[model samples]
Each structure stands twice: as structure tokens, then as C-alpha cells.
Target: MRVGVDIEDGGLARITLRRADAGNAIDLAMARGLLDAARACAHGSVRAVLLTGEGRSFCVGGDLREFGALSGAALERHLMAVTDALHDALRTFAGIDAPLVAAVQGAVAGAGIGLAAAADVTLAADDASFTAAYTGVGYSPDAGVSWSLPRLIGPKRALDLLLTNRRVPAGEAAAIGLVTRVTSPDRLAAEARRTAESLRRGPTAAFGATRRLVAAGLSADLGPHLDSEARALAGLAVSDVGREGVAAFLGKRDPDFTGGAHRL
Candidate 1:
């Protein structure tokens, strides 16, 4: 596989897109590798995931050369399969008990943008760039960009970016709320990893439930999701960990929760 994955203390796994020479472009093999890594992270001891690039660029986009060879049914099938698999991979990312933080530097375009938007939180280096390159050529946004963009930057901003294929830098990206935080290139990794570690060491199952509720709230009305949230809270409120947390807060001491979910 062209990607690399390592899990350290705090249950945080760092997954690097390793094709820096080509600006970490997603080729066929790399797409499969990314999906595999996401699935592995979903099932592993990793509570949080830090997505990054090995060298200069986080990910330039999909390999254009790979697109040239396709035509008619073959082309349609190729594009559909890759995008579908990638979307599936990203959808699973949301289910991760701990947050998914993207540590981005350099170019992030096309499918790369999709990957970034898939993350629960994004941390970009001062030099990082973002572009929706799909319309620049003769393609459309995939990797659930249509779904994610409207949620991140609003529908109007997403339409403008997609229509114009504009290249946005870190400062502008942060201002527009596409990325959560931006730091100096030297501190990007540390900053992102720190956030991931914080999440990893916190309430695992509660985070997972919260994530689901938030996602559900995005598309559905609060009236419908209220019931779901009520059920989740009810379950948590009766749990031993919750009682301990409440006691610890009232007693002015740190909560010791041993009822951590091993499956997470």
C-alpha cells in the first residue's frame, strides 16, 4: 500500500497518505489502500485518527493520467467505483468513536477536498491550499463533497467554489469555517495530534453517540432526532460512568471512568 498507518499512545492513529512525489494523488491502488486503512481504523484500538500527508502536499487530487485511459462504460464504471468506495470509507469515518482530524499542508484539491471535508475536524498548516477541481476539468464533485460542503461552508459558498474552482489558502479557509484550526507548518502535526489525543483520552462511547446525533441533525429536523438524543442520554444517564462523572463534578474531583468501551 502507498499509505502508512501507525497507532501510538492515547489511542490515536496517524494515517499518512504516502504519495508525496505526485503530491499524494489518489491512484487506483491508493484509493483501495485508503479505504482499507479507514476500515482498519474503524475496527482497531484506534479511538482517534489523524489523516496527513508524508511529504509536501497533503493530496493533490486524483491522478489525471488514470482518467485518460477510460471511455464509455469502462470510464463510467471506473469513476463510479472509486468514488463510491471512497464515500463509503468516509461515511465510516464519522462512526469512529474519537474524532477524525486532518493535518493538512500544501495542495488539497478534487478528491482530496472530499477527504478533508469527510473529517470531523480539520487542522491545516499556514501554507495549505484547498480547491474544488472537479468542475475545472469536466467532472463533478464526488466523495460526498456535495453533502459535506453545504454542511461546512454553506450551500452558497460550496456552489461558488465548485463553480469557479477557486483555490483557497489556509487563512481564508479558516475564516470560512472549512478548517477548524490553522498553525505554522512546523506545528501542524503537533496541533492536530494534540486534538486527536485529547479526544482519544476522553469519553469514547459518548463521543460516538454525539457524532451520530450531530450528523443526523444536519439533514433531519430536530423533532425527529430529539427522540434519538433522548434515548442516548437516557442510556448514558443511568450508566455507572455517568454517575461517577456527576459525583466527581459535584465533589470537585476528576472522574475515573473504568467503564470504557473496549470495542471502540
Candidate 2:
């Protein structure tokens, strides 16, 4: 399989890009596999997701060699199909209650940047480098790179990267808001897993609500956003997780959201 999906204990779903030889590039099959993995994670039981790529690099980008094999309308159609699957997978991940954590290493360019940015928490290895390689190949952005980049690091910076295809090292990428944190390459996987596991033990619905609120707040008016926040908080406050959280706080204990009979 080009993508590996494993649901470990505590509802932490691990989605791995398995094309190490190709720098985990997104070919058509891998795109479809990612969609399948996303659909699996969308199941109600999943609490968190961790995305990683095997080998030295996280992902270089789309499989350009595959694209280069075709021309004319055929190439256009092929790319559309690839993006269709990839975009749908990203949308599915976004719509899920489970928060996503990405552990990126080595080269993170083009669609790889989009995938990293899409994560709720992106942990990049010290060796990781980011570039917007679309324009260099005479292609426009796909996999939501155009939408995510401007929102992530602002339009001017986004344009500079997209236009120049200049590589941004891990430190600069984090400083520019392209990644959440940077760690040593050796510790990247462990840190990501730890982060995902911590999230898995929290209130899934509340996380989902917050994710949606943040996404909406980007384009929403302040008044309407406040109203949305109010409604969301009210709804969650009455939920079982909320009750457990309150009880735990008062009892000086940690809350258990895993549907156990133990005290909060």
C-alpha cells in the first residue's frame, strides 16, 4: 500500500505515507489511499490522527514523473483526478472531530507544505525544508496550497515563496507560521506521537468545535464569530465530557473521556 493506516490503542490513528523511494510523493494511487485512510479516521471512535512519511523526506510533492508521462487534455484530466482525491482527503480530515498532528522531515514542498499546514499541529524536523515549487514547474497550486499559504504566512510571503521557489529551512518555516514546532530528526516521530496521544485523551467533540470555530473565524465577522463561540461553548458545557471535566476539576483529578466507569 502506498499509504498505511493503523489505528492504535486509545483511538490514535496513524496515517503513513509509504513511498519512501519517491520521497512519499503523491501519485494517483497514493492520493486515493489517503482518501481511504481519511474516511477510516472519520469513524466516530477515532480521537486523534498522526500523519508521517517514511524515510529521509516527508514528501517532495506530487509525482511529477507520472504527470510528465502525459500531455494535452490527458494530462489535465489526470491531474484533476489526482487533485480530486487529494482535496477530498484533506476535506475529510478537516471535517473530522479528531485533531491531526503531522511530523514532517527533510523536503516539504508543494503539496507537502499544504499537508503540513493543514495539520492542527505540525512538527518539523530540524533538517526539514519547505518550498512552493508549483510555479517552477509551470503549474498553479493544487491540494489547497494557494488557499492555505496566504492564510498561513500572509499574501506577500506566500507570493514570494510561490514565485521564487526558494527553500525555507525548518527554523524560518516555523518563524513564518508554516509549522508549529521544530525538533531534532531523531525525536520527530516520538514528539508527534506524544502530542497525538495527549489529544486523544481529551474531549474529541470540544476539539472539533474549536477547530471549526478557528477555521470560521478566519473569514467571519467578529460579532458573528462571538455568537458562534457562545453557542459552541454552551452546547459543549452540557455534554458528558464537559460534566466530567468539571467534576474532575472540582475533585482534583484528571478526566477520563474514554467511557470508563472510573471517577472523572
Give the least accurate 10-residue stretch of model 2, judged by summed lDDT: 255-264
- Write one digit per residue (lDDT tens) for candidate 1, span 1-264: 688888775577888899888898887778878888788788646778889988889988888888788889998888777776676778778767667889889999988888888788898999999999999998888878888888999999999999999899999999998888889999988888788877776666677778888888887887878888898888777776567778889999877653455422
- For model 1, the superposed segments whose C-alpha errors exceed 4 Å read 257-259, 262-264
Candidate 1: residue 1 Cα off by (Å): 2.1
Q: Best-fitting candidate, measured by lDDT?
A: 2
- How much lDDT does each candidate structure score? 0.83, 0.92
- Backbone clash count, each prediction separately: 0, 0
Badly placed stretches (over 4 Å) of model 2 are 260-264
- Model 1 scores a C-alpha lDDT of 0.83
Score candidate 1 by TM-score against the native.
Answer: 0.93
Our tally of clashes for model 2 stands at 0
